[model samples]
Target: MLPLALAPLRRLFLGLALLLPAAGCSSGGGSGADDAVEAANAQNAQKIGAADVTEKQEADARFLVKATSNALLEVELGKLAQARATAPAVRAHGAALLQSRLDLLAALRALADAKKLAIPPALGEDEQEAYHEVSAQTGSQLDKHLMALLVKTQNQDEDAFDDMKDDAYDGDIRGLAAKYYQPIKAQLDAAEEAADAAEKLP
Candidate 1:
């Protein structure tokens, strides 16, 4: 026999009593959904970081492959130029390329080792075909084309290295790029001069 107003007040008090345990669970020893969500976010962040490192390693590996391909092509082309070019400067440039190969290979290998990356041992098919085409030529046939190829390839490499030097994800690769850029620039200059000289030849 409660009063009409007393009935709603009793119901309201009962509802509050029922809600108290839930409020305590949130504030007390229970690890609520907030903690679970935060933990999940932390784990996801860790996964993302790991994924980023994997991507960076892959890019560094690609860099090594490209460098090795260019180096091998340069060495092979240099030998052909040395043997067949009629121009003395082209032959000397070929000799210089061959000499530079040793230093370049060592530097590339060191970078690969430091990064735990495997260096590719051979050139791609297009480059091998280009190598054979150059190898089959002799005298003036080899001179201008070889010089042109040198200018093209060396300039392309310089361009790539310039673009990559600052953006390398690995600090070591960045350092290597910075260190090598100057030498590659010098090489590119020589290749340009050789190309210009060949064009000027009588």
Candidate 2:
């Protein structure tokens, strides 16, 4: 009876010893699975952040270009109205500058389409037609504006030029240009900061 009881105890000890390593392996496997999941999640987060930064950079560039173009156009239009001396070359150059603006607008539209962004409300049918016509023209409108101003300045008729300047720039045009430029510049700066922040994260 004593031997039989001792045999049962020995068998029980052997069985427990075998199960110990398997239990340890299971715990290690669970830890490995957890580590893998964490690494995958981290990788996904990084990709998402990078994509956001890229998108922001593109948008900022677009806004900057638009603001700059609009400002230049306003200045040109002011000069055109004020110039007392009108030459064919001056008009041609002015037309060319206007055309450049159109080209820029077209490019913007194409980019927006590619990115699935909305078309600007200000871009109307006439604007599009004007842009196309400008692209087709040979001369630079910017040069024309400058030449006209130079001719007027050479004449030294300050009073006439001054009066034209007043007529050219109404309160409404200047105000609108400033309003658009300022807000877009602010947005661009913020987008840049956001991109920098994304780079820092993780």
| Candidate 1 local lDDT, residue 158 | 88
Off by over 4 Å in 2: 1-51, 54-85, 118-120, 123-202
Deviation of model 1 at 168, angstroms: 0.3
lDDT tens digits by residue: candidate 1, 26-138: 11122333232233223323333333244544555567667766787788778877777777888888899888876888898787654334454455555666777777766
Candidate 2 Cα deviation (angstroms), residue 77: 3.2
lDDT of residue 155 for candidate 1: 79
For all candidates in order, the CA lDDT equals 0.64, 0.34
Clashes of 2: 8
lDDT of 2 by residue, 1-202 (tens): 3354234323433433333321111111234323322332233233323332334333333343333334233234334523421334344434443444454456544543332223332322322333334334333443333343333322322222233223322232223334333433443343234333323433
Give the clash total for candidate 1. Answer: 0
